[model samples]
Target: MTLRPISEDDIQALVDERLDTARRSEVEAYLAANPDARTRVDRLRTLGRDLRTAFAPIATEPVPAQLNLAHIVEARRRPRLQVSAWQAAAAAILLALGGLGGWGLHGTLAPAGVDALAQEASANFAVYAPDRTRPVELAASDSAELARWFSARLDRKVGVPDLRSADCRLMGGRLVATPHGPAGLLMYDDHRGTRFVVLMRPMAEPGDAPMREHRFGSATGYAWAQDGLGYSLVGAADPAVLHPLANTIRRTTATNT
Candidate 1:
């Protein structure tokens, strides 16, 4: 019997472990013959695992009383006979307090260059990490093309760093718009199935730290500046896990540039 040619969706399904018994075997056979597809599939599986691990604590934590939507709706349904001026003022004060409380729930209130980059990188990681189907706009097979495209878009010579030495394999990358201009985002995953992202943009100031660690909420990252370019390695993994990867990326990027 002739086996059908595998599509991108099939590879994604394999990564997600959604394929059936027969299909799984077929995909495994196909991947065994295609080293590139096998590598991409491995990265996708790693990303899925990392995403689950990172968000698992939130899943197990009890919902905040203020954030319980059902309870809030039920409370709203209770009748208020009348709103006196004093009661109105008290209500307004409570509303402001609620807003402040919500703001404080997201950790790290300070503003700085590294902090801003870390926030953006973390946001991007949240968006793309769990998506095994299409996390990157460019394929790893076209690394050279992606390099030229991103360099032109950013008006600088930036190439994708080879992170295999750090046991993290590059899946692909995507281009995004930032306040400074175009930024490049590259995705990678390690052997243990932890996902990480690297974001690069043009630096605004001349003097910035070569490397800085940042943490906000459950996110941990490292941001740095070199050669007038700002770089960040962001993920939901712990700081200990990300620090070494950040160093590896820094050295690789410096050499590539």
Candidate 2:
């Protein structure tokens, strides 16, 4: 019996596992006629396997003690007192003095470069976090399209990290203006209903390490570079969750290169 030709949608659905049992069978039958389709599937499967092997080790690590749930709950319940203008000015003065003192200490103090980057990242997150409409230029449901679109906008190749294993789903992306011109924002959500991570990178700057972590406010973020592109992971998830995701991103991205 002659098999029906496989449609692009069929191949895509198979890639995404959205095909039903009968449709899956049909796709397999079609592949028997077209070995090229099988080759593509095999390549994708191998890529996924490599990513899993390289990064899954991080998932086994113990959660950090600093991520105590009780502390987070207590912190949420604490009163958020508003400071008066005079009080704000006084606090600013104190901060300036502290900064100057730290600067005087020089080598004794860690450089504020990372801290500045964290503040910048936090500020960027704050601006978009409350945005309910058009938070992302591309939706997570269209991650492949997003990857292509962002790659063009940033003038570098970009890829979305698969988070299903980590129990998260993509939440779309937005383009935001930054000190370095335009940037991309890709958000994700885990089972907790909490928005987990925001991956951001300069639309222009290129060349950096595979990963860097920054602590901003009460949150920690991981950023990285791979294949001549930059990436940043910002979220409230525990380091245990975020770190593995970062490793996966690094591995997947490196493989693609």
Candidate 3:
């Protein structure tokens, strides 16, 4: 008998790395045959990485004094809070499953939250990249002014990396908002009108990992945290085309810092 065809849930499980080895292999085979499904799975994985980057620090933070065991117990005695072990276990399971048991929970879980940078970046690119009339708030000719604007808003020095060698020139930038605060997006485009965005904002905590990479649907991204700032570069270009630009930006930024 034929195995049940892969469902969206299976793709999500694969993206979440929740599938067992055998199941994962099956999903991989399905993805290999279906490029569109593979892209969606990649996007989900990228969103998960961004969420973890934003929220992982909370897991390591010290409990507040008001939330200590003694204080909690005294509060419970005064105004009894009831939660069964089963309820707690179920809550834990939900968190483990990324706050839902199914893919239907995707759009419901995020709406400009701090953990949604990748999702927003991907969405923003999908929205603005193709627009010919008005893609950026500022124009490239005022490169200095644009950098100054972003630097002032971000409260950190930010710059547009020159990628002329890569045939992509600065197309200006815009200030975007995340749950934490305002973020910066420096846009660029090649002669062919292929667009890319470099998004940057402050990190929620210190000591995050130095660097990582992700793919959001048809786009590729490189995410890194350095000197209390987090940066992500997203584009629809293949990884080979994107990697050099990302590296050049990282090196240029490091030198300036």
Candidate 4:
């Protein structure tokens, strides 16, 4: 019997475990013959699994009392008889607080240099990590092309880090914009399905900087600068475990540059 051609979406579905049972065997057979696609699917599965594990706690948390619908409606109707100046002020304050809460998510306020790099990596991880279908535009088998892509976009000689020694396989990468400029975001995963990201962008000025660990809500990342480039490796893992992995990236990047 003739079989249907496998598309990128099919591979994504296989990795996400969302492929139809009838097509599951067919896709497995195809991946068995295609090493690159097989590898990409494995890493993507890891990324999705890790994303769920990391965000499950936050997903289960109850909504804050201040954000409760009943509370807001009650407050609005509390002064039906006559809205006093203090009541009006309180309403305005609640609105102001809501706006302030979102400022960080929108990157309206961020730290300078390395911290910003880490924060951006963490933020990007939150976005792409959860996306099982299209976490990245390019796959790890295209590392050479990925390297050239990042190099041209950043206007620097950027190279893809080889994390095989660290047991973190490169899944893929895509270009992400930062307040500073365009940044390259690479995703990776380990055997245990632990996923992480590495973000690199050219610094405004060239100077060596010490490695710093940053925690962005539930995400943890390590950021540093060497030569003229800034790099951040972020994941949902703890700082101690990620420390060595970040070092591995540092050495790989240094050698590649």
Candidate 5:
């Protein structure tokens, strides 16, 4: 039987991980064959993750005083005073998704320097690794174009690192905002769908530094710097397997400059 052409709804369902097993397999095959479609799927997946991450915390926080049942009832019973448009908007927002489902994130500051790079990479991994439909902003079939777009964003020539020796296929890349600045994110996946990410950004404080291992959440990876660009390789892969792979990326990117 012939499967219908992949549509936006299909892409969304893929990101949401709601597609049936057989149709999902077909969709994955289609994404692999079409770089542009895969990119769009990745983007849609990323946007969904960003929303959930942003709002999930807010959704968990205790109801504010204004939103409390007793307070709401009391306010309603009191004489209805004229409310400014701003106050009405704020109340509406509080009663809506922005107020109940998200908006709790406000206190923690992002890590600085190389630490930030590793954090960003790990965060990106968390955001993308589980996505089977589209995990990269660009598909490997368009690596050359992805390279150009990445370099343009960084204002430096950034070459996509070859990870074939590691049995990891280039899944393409995207530009991600970082504490330092905009950075390039290159993703790779192996035969088992094991995903690894390489994050590169221009260093501000210490442009050159030795490699050091780091851990963020469940991800174990290494971060280092050369010249003025900082790099972090992050994944849930075993440390023993990642160390040498990180070294290989270092050597390859070293020559790229």
Candidate 6:
């Protein structure tokens, strides 16, 4: 039988492995003649392998029974004051020492929220990144399809800008939950290791004015908001390596919007 032209739905179905033997063979033959489609197939295959390996260990673990009943009664109980007297005394001493500069002292002592975000991004990157086969929900080779898949899941349009011209290649993207809402995790790699950028719609009130730069451990981050979207770029790379990519992303997003 002669092969039919591949539609977007057909490609998706093939990726989902819904095709029968004959149709699968037809698609394989078609992919043999199309390099881009072949690359996409290979990438998806890799992702399947990675996902299997990443999740296989969980299947063998036993579930605990007491974990459910112990928490059920606690939910209906009244709130308890758990603060110790010693803890309150220490807080009083600190407040007295801080005196009129308490606000400044608090600012200096408080953990930076941006740093927390960067650390979470990096830890997630490290865990999910080893899957060279399927590191993202949408591969770079399938930008349009990925955009469609992610946009629908996130309830907003998502775009993947090509940075290969700037010597960076798309590593893939994953869906992650954030305090604001569900966020898209798009990663890229250059000569060094992986760099991550998170895309999401802005929260009703992000609390403070816009923060441009944040440093956490060895990672650095940049955040900005425009056109009802929030963009955050984080990586262990220096400002020199990241600045250009940040500019490229900002420019591309700005132009397209």
- Which 10 consecutive positions of candidate 5 have the poorest summed lDDT? 97-106
lDDT of 6 by residue, 1-257 (tens): 55588776766678889999888888878888999988988898789889999999898788566556666567534333234555687677556434312123343543334433443454445545556667677777777776776688767677777777778788778777643456677878876656565544444444433537766557667765556566677777788877777777777777764
- lDDT of every model, 2 decimals: 0.78, 0.65, 0.74, 0.85, 0.80, 0.64
Colliding residue pairs in candidate 6: 46-133, 47-133, 47-134
Query: Which regions of candidate 5 deviate over 4 angstroms?
Result: 1-109
Q: Which residue runs does candidate 3 get wrong by more than 4 Å?
A: 1-116
- Candidate 3 residue-wise lDDT, 45-95, digit = tens: 889999999999998999899879998788777644345665687666446
* Per-residue lDDT over 142-209 for candidate 2, one digit per residue giving the tens place of the 0 to 100 score: 88887777778777676776767767788887665444445567777778766655545542334655
Best by TM-score: 4
RMSD (Å) of each candidate, 1 decimal: 33.2, 34.2, 29.1, 33.2, 32.1, 33.2
* TM, every model: 0.56, 0.49, 0.55, 0.59, 0.57, 0.50
Residue-level lDDT tens digits of model 4 in 129-230: 878899989999899999999999999899999999888899999998776778999999889878899999988779878899988777788999999799
Name the regions of candidate 6 deviating beyond 4 angstroms: 1-123, 130-133, 191-194, 206-211
User: Candidate 4, which segments miss by more than 4 Å at Cα?
Assistant: 1-109
List clash counts for every candidate, in order. 0, 4, 0, 0, 0, 3
Q: Give a tens-digit lDDT track for model 5, residues 1-257.
A: 87898887888899999999998999999999999999988898889999999889888888887779988887876645445665787556444322212222233543566776677677777776777887888888988998899789888888889989878899888887754568888898889988898988888865688888987656787999898788999989889989999999999888866
Ranking by TM-score: 4, 5, 1, 3, 6, 2
The Cα RMSD of model 3 versus the native structure comes to 29.1
lDDT tens per residue, model 1, 140-248 = 8888988898899889899899988878888889997553567888888888777888988877776456688877567788999888788999877877778988998
lDDT of 2 at 41: 82
Q: Please tell me which model should have the higher TM-score, number 1 or number 6.
A: 1
